[model samples]
Target: MIAVLFRWDIKAGSEQLFKEGWSEIVHLNIEKHGALGSRLFKSKDGEWISYSKWISEDHFYNARKSLDNTEQARIKMAQAIIRAYDPIVMIPVIDHLMATETTHINQLS
Candidate 1:
């Protein structure tokens, strides 16, 4: 799989708008394209981050070449909140990996 990392520093009072737009975009990418899915994160420095996964680089590129009207609209909505936007494409690599048993938040205490 290939991953796309998007970082945005949003303007004040635009959080909800950004989130709504992001959700729409993500849904479209996954359903229409071949995206595995995505996750959103917030940094202490006030950057909003999105990590999206695709089945392959071809899937990602093909989707970018053909965006529908709704997708374009969602992209515009996301652009409206931008102070800065940076996007990066990456491939994952690891030497050692292990799985941990599932644990719930309630079990932490």
Candidate 2:
């Protein structure tokens, strides 16, 4: 599998809009593009980030060539953001994540 990281710096008061758009896009990816799904995060500096997985780098690039049902969501996200960065590709050297009910950040404590 391959990992790709994405980041967006949003305009003030646009958090909900951004999230809604992101959710729409990601669901489409999982349903039609063979994505393994992604985890969303907010950086300490406030950028929105997502780490997504794909079966291969080719899958990621292929997925980007089409945006069949994500037009409105893409518009919302584009309007909400001040900046969007190019996706960062990564190679996996380890797999240490564990599955559990407490896997999320809020459940860590």
lDDT scores in order: 0.75, 0.87
Candidate 1 TM-score versus the reference: 0.76
Cα error, candidate 2, residue 46 (Å): 0.9
Candidate 2 residues lying further than 4 Å off, grouped into runs, are 100-109
| Candidate 1 lDDT tens digits, 71-108 | 65566566656565757999978525344343363144
Q: Tell me the lDDT of model 1 at 93.
A: 87
Assess the local accuracy of residue 101 in candidate 1 as a C-alpha lDDT between 0 and 100: 47
lDDT tens per residue, model 2, 17-73: 888888898888888888887888998999889999998888888888987888999
Candidate 2 TM-score, true structure as reference? 0.88
Candidate 2 weakest lDDT stretch, 10 residues: 100-109
RMSD over all Cα atoms, model 2: 2.9
Clashes of 1: 0
